[model samples]
Target: MSPFNNHLEVAGFEKILLLKFSICVLFSVGVWVIYTQKARLSSIPNSKKALFFLLSFIILRILPFLIIYVILDFSARSDVRMFYDSALGALKLGFVYRDFETAYSPIFPYLTALPLLIWDSAKAIVLEMVLVEGIILWFTYKYYKNSLGNYYLLLYLMLPAPFVFSILGGQEDIWMWAFVLWTCFILRKNSNWLLAGLIMGLGLLTTKALLVLYLPALFIFAKKPWQFMLGLLIVGIPSLAFMYYHSELLFLSPIQQANDPRTPNIWSVLHPLTNGFVPIGPKILNWVGLVSIQALGIFFAIKSKKTSKPHYFLVFLFLIISVWLMIIQQSSLSNYAYVFLMPMVFFFGEQTNKKWLILLLLLNLFVVIQPPIWWGIGMPIFHSLSDLNSGYKVLEYITEIGVVVLLFAFLRIIIKNFKTTNNSNV
Candidate 1:
């Protein structure tokens, strides 16, 4: 059977199963090689190390997907199709939210559609995402080279979540963090608060609206709060005015998304008990989740205010996003964990204990595979209350439990690191 829906039947990609298994083996070997050769790699020039990292990422993450989908004509599956449809819709309508319905922010559809102008295929969207991921990875390496070292890049590439979600699934979640990181990079000198804020606001416009959750923490951590606020308002006011004039659909998009509850969230776990019915309804749950996330962001901001270390800000950022994934109504999929993968790896990768690192790897594995199980097994067979089966129910419960455990594991790591950092300071 072809992976991701019988590509054997549709796309006629021969030996696809072998191809996939080979890619998996190769990725495992690549990771092992990097791990064992770390000492030798440390002695190499930074430029050479950077080249090796990029090449490894391409060979492991990019080439396999390209070979399967582009070279062999395997059909694009999952959210990439939706991304293509939204982009095509926006192209046809000449407007994103006004002309067609999309849950994404105002600028995303346009950005996705740009590639379609030349390539005119869904593959173009995947390639566009790959390009963006590459740029993000380059910048990440550049920014963290001195502090975290090249191992961070290698670890990030080795993680299955980024490859599965960003390259294979074509998710835009990581783009949100890419923007946040770029903002941090801009303000690394502690002199560019206004520019950083403008960049961040632009990121919010282009990426998911949830990126706003990072604002409170960012404001608290910023050296010049007033300047950042001014820059944010500069971009935000014009963007809001343009959105209001262009599309009433923009305002209605979030409400529309709230009606459907996704899997691997708290709501999904309780869905079996509720029989897909809640007394409060999904909209209320949506607001409640948002408020809860915002409250946590504010709390973390206040708690970490005294600590000016950049990594702590990232920890709080990861914490806030973790809370969002755990409780948010529309966050239904674990793939959104891509947003926090950077901080998780950067902070937790240095652990002397292998247990936390091992656990993190297992969680990444769970996250990478959860979407396929939910989509292929749970959604198809157990979508409706009447359709549920005992075996499928057990599998669904296990996946949900994995999500909950992953959330708690992240919280634990964050707290541990926080205390360790403070104690070292003392």
Candidate 2:
């Protein structure tokens, strides 16, 4: 690279960061002023105030992710180990119609390709991510506006992890989750079923994380088959399209799956463990892990005195996890960390105290590091299991360690909840 060109890129990227930082800071101050200016939150009881503070504390805890990722991009953005790299390759290598040869739904990578075609720079692409993320933020705040006051909105503002996905890896994980949530809100309002289905379906194609949506959809649409069917239709069409076009090529090719050296899900990490150690298939372990966690949660959930639409959401999450881990591969570290959100939103809404909140926060920290380490941590773990000398070996090891601990942790919580519930019944 020419020194002049290098200098220009550095100068230009710095300018962009300065501009973004300025805008974000100003926007944050405006939001804070609007929040404090009103008497809406002032009238809340002292306890709610405290709960609000703790929740916001958790959100703010990850706020520095933006700065760290912005720097990481300079060095690691081109790293082939990133999931985004594989997704992007499908587009950059001209495999749009033959997405099966690559991994994942082609839409996200195609979008990434679009931005790169114009600017050919990671900074510009991430800026686009920030913009899209900002829009999602606006709608997210809107979704909770009626249910949450300033305290809750503050948590949304500082939601460190989701924001990090946008700022750092240029990941579309948040959008997938956000769209699925939007579909839920729309369904709650009795809005368009086809649109909702399409929204969720597209979310599914983009990231496996949205596979969680299908769990909720199953029960909600169990009796209402049409809605469920419609969602499947919408969600599956794009993926099927890729499959149809690439029928000669392998579907769900091993190479595509092999891209991730570490994943807690059976496809990437579990099967390898069995091959290296036990004769058992990782799929078997996955089903056992998922179903065991699920059955206990659902059985307890149904028996609990509390039965509401929101409670049903928890059941939906339980089902999602059951099927997701058992069936899908490539569920990432952040994906597992996402499980903590369930307890936080659920227990907090139930008026469970700060102690419960703190416990889940600690658990969140634990689970957050599981599988396909997001930022280079799990490489060694992956290497240990896949091939100790390979770059991704450590990723497997950590994934193995993480999964064992998480499996035990998930079971422990379920048993604890069950025993507690039974004792209360007695």
Candidate 3:
């Protein structure tokens, strides 16, 4: 049985379950309204648009949690329970890597634990997540406001995937992107390379180790590699020293995380055929994926050297990360799609392709609903081949295929842009 199930009250569980279904229904209605009233929404004043988005975000994301945990006094489920466990463990142990094990960065457990210093409840960790999400949303809006307009923000806010993954699952996959977005804002001046590197180094320490995969894009785009490297070393050295002082276990976290079960990915889809065995094995596939991402980053850098546009950079960065998520073993959960939300909005906001937009919306719907269906039926959120059921497996296949198609479409767009840039240069 799941840990949260042990403490769950029947009345609370039923209420929360009903609330989840209601939120999904409301999200569907909101999407329909947005689609039918696009012209009317676009005509609204910027101030009102911002206010509406904020209010809607709070209602959909924040209020439900407040109702469930605060008023209803229910135990949080899914990763939030694990997060609370890690925080409490950190508080008791006093050092994260040394005294305990966590797949997250060294700072993450402590950061999650910070809220407990105030309220001393697991709900505090969820509140901390909300705050982190708010920071991410604010940075995303500020950075993309002029380039993409309010429509992109509207879509991001209204999207069910972001709400489900970030709020309901309490996943922090997008936390790394928050620092990336802030660095994007800083790099707008072109002379802030050092500061950007410093911020990224801090991100490396606090957020997912996957942030390292994004470094190639930053390095390729840097005006002065030496200055950026210097700034990275400034924080990198101290962070490394701190980790070393704590324990050698700190360096093993990534390897440990890599052994986690595969999810909503091609490997998982093919698992039944292989009888839950990979012909090439996961470690080899992981290395191949990493090497492929590095090669793609280099190829994109070469093709787009003359294109210093910020939006193009976002596209390339998204491509690199998307490739990693698509191919890498043990790393392709549907929730990871949240990382693509901001970049997708910024990259495709002006495109008139209804097919791509429709595909994206369908992908979000499948991704959002899959979790609830699986959990509601007592299936594990991240499952092995043996754990699969026909009901949940169908959604998994659809969501994975949709992601693959969407990613290929993005690649086509990037290639087309590259060709346009080259022809214009000639």
Candidate 4:
């Protein structure tokens, strides 16, 4: 029988199950979350309300795991054989066993396994993540006062995709949120590039390893460019050194997942759209397309009307696409759907109070309308591709391509800003 069928010898699955049952019985956080807002709303004062509300929220936040736990206990047992393979690989390599990751480091696997040893059944991981992600959101609101409003933290915690990912997929991507936001805060707000790059490097563990996602914004927003660059190097150089040391991995951390020969990427999209295909022999074409996407995004950033803002948005879009591409490239688009949610939040957030936040929000509300996931322009194409069994690769192509266009459009806005700056100087 496979490890999944047996639940590995890591701390006895039965013991873990007993422990979780005990915890659930002792603490009704999940149940409290289910009825939180309504229960607490009319009773609390304004000052303590948000904080009380947050506690109730964490319950719902952590509820998915409990539900999954029930299913896992009842027979919907997950084939964690894959997880075991990854962990043992780490052990065998004496470098932390990481399965399913060929091009990247073992940090993420360790994160998953570490939590399981203590809490059992991925619940421990999500619990830690909710707390961390919640703190980071609070930090964002406190500092970026103008950029955020009251209840934003609540909203971030409660977003449907985030809710599902945390409870269902048992993802730790939220921790990455802290690192990414830290990079942004330090480099853009505090002029600490070295720290920024380091945090950004650390952030790679959350999803894909993309160091420069927030750098362009630093360049645009930094009042002191020299200090900013110095800070960037401090944080970024260490990871770059590691990548080089593991040069065996070929510095492919960012796009390692995309190198899968099976899936269609942006370049693959070209084959379908152009009615011509590039032979998949050497990897030169993939590199070319990847570089082209970054270059295109950067070019738009330089050309936009609001230089700093566009730089941040473009960088954010690139990071989002890079992660989406990594997953879809392998034809595994399950549970990681939340990757699109953050980018959507930012894109729409940018236009808030500009002209059509109300209109856009209303339209987006319709997307969750009935039965199907209506991602607007994506619904028909995604459906057709699914019917053909090419859904995974095609979705990858569409999402990344859409990100590229949105990135470029935002870049155009930056170009206009630069021109205005130049003219003012003249």
Q: Estimate each model's TM-score.
A: 0.84, 0.58, 0.82, 0.58
Candidate 2 similarity to native, TM-score: 0.58
Model 2 lDDT tens row, 1-426: 533233222343434334434444454454445345445654566557546544553444233334444544453232213444543565456564344233445455666556666655555556555556555544544454233444444533433333334454454444554555666566556645566666667766565533543444333433344665687686686667766676534544533442343445444454455654532334454445445545544555455424434323433444345334433434344444443342233223233345543443333332333322333332333322435443234533454545545544444554445334322111
Q: Across residues 16-80, which tens digit of lDDT does each residue of candidate 1 receive?
A: 32343344455555656666665665576765866777686788668966786778886766688
Full-model lDDT, candidate 3:
0.65
Better of 2 and 3 by TM-score: 3
Best-fitting candidate, measured by lDDT?
1
Q: What tens-digit string does per-residue lDDT give for candidate 3 at 368-413?
A: 6545544444433333455443534455455555655665565676
TM-score of 4: 0.58
Segments in model 4 whose C-alpha atoms lie over 4 Å from true places = 1-46, 49-53, 70-93, 96-106, 129-132, 141-158, 173-176, 205-207, 212-255, 261-285, 304-337, 343-347, 350-426
On the 0 to 100 scale, the lDDT of residue 176 in model 3 is: 77
Better of 3 and 4 by TM-score: 3
Error of 2 at 418 (Å): 14
